[model samples]
Target: MIALVRHGETDWNAAHLMQGSSDIPLNDTGRQQARDAGDKLAAERDAGEHAWSAVVSSSAIRARETGELIAEKLGVPFIRVYPQWFEQHFGDAEGVPVEEAMRRWPNRDPEGFENDEQARLRALGALEQVAKDFDGRDVIVVAHGTIIRSALMSLTGRELGFLGNATASRLSQGAEGWTVHTFGGETLEDELGEPAAEIVAEVEPA
Candidate 1:
């Protein structure tokens, strides 16, 4: 089983900032959230011991810190960096509040973000790679919310729009291929203000 986790909170996160690839750090609350997530994931590990074959994270500091904490809890060294794990590029709206920016750029597609076709391909590709790369083994990836959602949609052929924060999407490798976890949220759910506050006390079963 491969468990994918979104990174913990950050300054922009608390402020409702877009935070594209701005490289922000976690505030105290964010740190606490990561810790809680880590503990939860650790508990879900096999044999009552949270362990993983490998752990990967985005290059961003926020993601790196989150990956580090999870790796430490799982007793696995942070093993890889995936540039694809970076948050979707929000262009001029990087750190601005979503509503404020949407009002300003009502007609403009945010910068660096892929069009629907691109997002679909990227998301699916990431999911396939992550699910296949660590086939049958429990691997954890700490990434941004948008990235995870895209990947989920890609794997499941669901479509972009719903993935919540501080929540993980699980994928299992099978004879058919990579399969998406139903427990995770989608992007639009975040837009409606759902994911950011959901507390996942435990991730997998320990």
Candidate 2:
């Protein structure tokens, strides 16, 4: 099983800013959230459930710090940093407020912005690589919300809304391909396919 964990919240997150690719450290609440996640994972480990073999993290500072804390709590040996797992680059919108960023770059086409499709592909490829490398072992991945959500969209073709900080999702591989079992602790029962019409309509046009 592969568990994807979004990093703890940062000040930008609280400010409702577009934090794409901006290196920000976790805030006090974020640090506590990381500790809480670690405690939960540690409890599961102690109970002999979901024993994690390794912890992997995005190269970003927030994600790395969260991963380190979880690894320490879970007694995992080391963390592998994967740069490809980095969040989508929001270009000029990087530190801007969310509403303004959306208005300015509705289609995410601002200069230097990473295309949504490309970001999705990168996120999928990174997870696939990790799945292959750690086959048969339960691994934890600490990454950003956008990339993680992008990966889920690639799998389910659904417009899953923003994932909360420190939340986890589970993905598993089978003969067909990768399947999302749970997202933010909610178990998914349907097969992967195009998103619902309402969901598609709700998304702002690029």
Using lDDT as the measure, the top candidate is: 2
**TM-score (C-alpha) between model 1 and the true structure:** 0.79
Query: Please, what is the whole-model Cα lDDT of each candidate in the order they appear?
Result: 0.68, 0.82
Query: If scored against the real structure, what TM-score would every candidate get?
Result: 0.79, 0.88
The deviation in Å at residue 103 for candidate 2 is 1.7
* lDDT for each residue of candidate 1 in 1-206, tens digit (9 for 90 to 100): 67778888887887888887799997877777777777777777755543467788888888888888877876777888777677777777887897798898787486665555555455555655666667667788888887777665555444445444556666566665555544453333444344432222211111
Q: lDDT of candidate 1 vs native?
A: 0.68
The TM-score, computed over Cα atoms with residue i paired to residue i, of candidate 2 is: 0.88
- Supply candidate 2's per-residue lDDT for 55: 90
Candidate 2 CA-lDDT value: 0.82
Writing each residue's lDDT as its tens digit, candidate 2 over 85-131 gives 99999888988999998898878787889988888779878887887
The positional error of residue 66 in candidate 2, measured at the CA in angstroms, is: 0.3
